[model samples]
Target: MGQFYCLHCDRYFANSTVRDEHFKTKRHKKRMKQMSGPAPHTQLDAELAAGMVGKARAPDCRGTLGAVEGLPFIFLLM
Candidate 1:
């Protein structure tokens, strides 16, 4: 038996047909969109841009996540 691999989805399929079908799935499409560019702007991004949530640090920057006045404290790992 031969296995077809989808690099984007990091999944293996039985054949090309199955792999191609998976590429059309919503999950795969969403992943592709996310990987293609920066994340879509939201309230949090807006606040960060406006300096309302303190300084927006890079993903690799090391710092403490202190309390923000009007925002919930959340931690993200990169």
Candidate 2:
């Protein structure tokens, strides 16, 4: 992996492919637009995630889930 700093976006990217993908994602464009306007409530999202994780884990009744060991690996590969 390699690092590249995108000055226009004011962020560091791990690789060129990821950086290109970011440029194509709605979020990055939205962030740039927000920079000229208003930023989203990211702190609120963090708080929500924290609260959810803080709650006791209930068994996932939706279905039997296998170990989530390779989820990220699978996503990245895809």
Task: Specify the highest-TM-score model's number.
Answer: 1
lDDT of each residue in 1-77, candidate 2, tens digit only: 35876665778888888888879888778767768764444553444445542334433312321233223322235
Q: Over the stretch 28-49, how does candidate 1's per-residue lDDT look in tens digits?
A: 9988887788545557556555
Model 2 stretches with alpha carbons more than 4 Å out? 7-10, 37-78
lDDT of 2: 0.55
Best by lDDT: 1
TM-score of each: 0.43, 0.35
Predicted structure 2, TM vs. truth: 0.35
TM-score of 1: 0.43
